[model samples]
Target: MFERFTKPARAAVVQSQVEARRLGHDRIDDSHLLLGVLAQEAGVGARVLTELGVGLDAARDAVAALHAPDAQALGALGIDLDEVRRKAEAAFGEGALERRFARRRGFFRRSTGHIAFTRPAKAALEDALRQALTLRHNYIGTEHLVLGLLTGGSSTAGRVLHRLGVRVDAAELRRRVLDELGRAA
Candidate 1:
């Protein structure tokens, strides 16, 4: 499948790993893949998403927000995360919040220095190939990757796209993709 990927597609996959590592994620998820795709400013996928008002910065913010603690929700109730953390640390000693939120170091920890792909991410890549085949394209490009991310319903990337008001339904995304392809051609 990788052998058929165009240069931009390969770059996006590689960039996903870099983004995952930079974000302190042990594994690359759909959000990381989307970030990778958006990083390619000249890629067809990036251009299409940009046209939809979902540029790199917007996508990055969405992914970062997903990782962020639900502080805003608490803030709505007049609770301050920082204030609660300060109180907890004062009573329980330093690093109280870190200890509380930290998971046990085991399976979730990276066994190797290399970041691994999450199941949904792998599925998206495979789906990219399927997308290319479905379109009767010889090469798997970034556009196919975008399609995969949109159609891979269980993925974080798909959820983000949906949240961003991009149509993620199969028919709608396909139509938009074909329109983009027609324009590019």
Candidate 2:
């Protein structure tokens, strides 16, 4: 999954994990993943979210709303938050001990390493990269990344983007990308 990510994208995942640890979060959630995606600063996913006015706080709020105990909030949301946490730990390594040390020292860990990503986010990134490869794109485009985010299926990010009016129809986005590339050429 990590192999498909651009260096910046990978860094963003790492950055999110580190940020979560600094915040004393035990699990890497979708909110953390969205923040990490934003931290990348140069991906289509980030740009699309930003253009749709989806800020980090807004994304966090959206996630929190869905996290309610009410099962009726979303029918068949189908995400195992615990599994997501485990995947994050596997991908980015556990930070519980490191975070504790930083807290004790009255310092925050801002150094970037292999920070974890929530499972949905990881799946989204991987799917997006796979789509890009299928299309024979030399570089992963923002649209590709956005589509990847969508592929995670019923995610906080997907729901929030829909509510914010960011449409990500794969064919349309791909056409736009091709058009832009053609114009550039």
Candidate 3:
């Protein structure tokens, strides 16, 4: 199945792992895959998303927000993250989060090298293959990947894409991606 991936599709897969690591996530979710597609600027996936007003940075920010440390729930308890960070930084001299992680590494530690793909992410990849076969495409491209994400409507990536104002739910995103692919060809 991987052998059928085009250059850009392959890049997106690799980028997804990189994105997961960069975001401090031990697992790669569908959102990471979408971020990877967005990172591949020359890919039709990125172009289609951009045309729909979804930029890579904005997507990254959205994914990060989802992983944020329950700020809203904590705020309900009158615990302000910003204020906590500020106070911690003032006492610790700066980069308090970094220092905390460094301290944890000295004692509590595990293999941080491997990032497993969450079930939804794996399903998206499988769906990409199905999409390619359904479309009678010999090779799976970034467009197929976007279709896969769209098909997995419950995935974090799908939700983020929709929230970012893409027309994935309405089924127009596939058309936009195909249009971009056509123009690219």
| Alpha-carbon TM-score of each model against the true structure | 0.77, 0.55, 0.81
Local distance difference test scores for all models = 0.82, 0.62, 0.83
Off by over 4 Å in 1: 72-112
Clash pairs, model 2 backbone: 44-142
Candidate 1 C-alpha error for residue 106, in Å = 7.5
Indicate whether candidate 1 or candidate 3 has the larger lDDT: 3
Order of the predicted models by lDDT, top scorer first: 3, 1, 2
Candidate 3 at residue 115, lDDT? 71
Off by more than 4 A, model 3: 77-108
Q: Give the candidate number with the greatest TM-score.
A: 3
Can you list the residue pairs that collide in candidate 3? none
Lowest-scoring 10 consecutive residues by lDDT in candidate 1?
100-109
Give lDDT tens digits, candidate 2, residues 1-185.
45656776667667667656655555565556666677665666566567657776666555555544554433458766556557877877885323432232777655444445567766776777787887787556555665666655587666766666667665665565455546545
Tell me how many clashing residue pairs each candidate has: 0, 1, 0
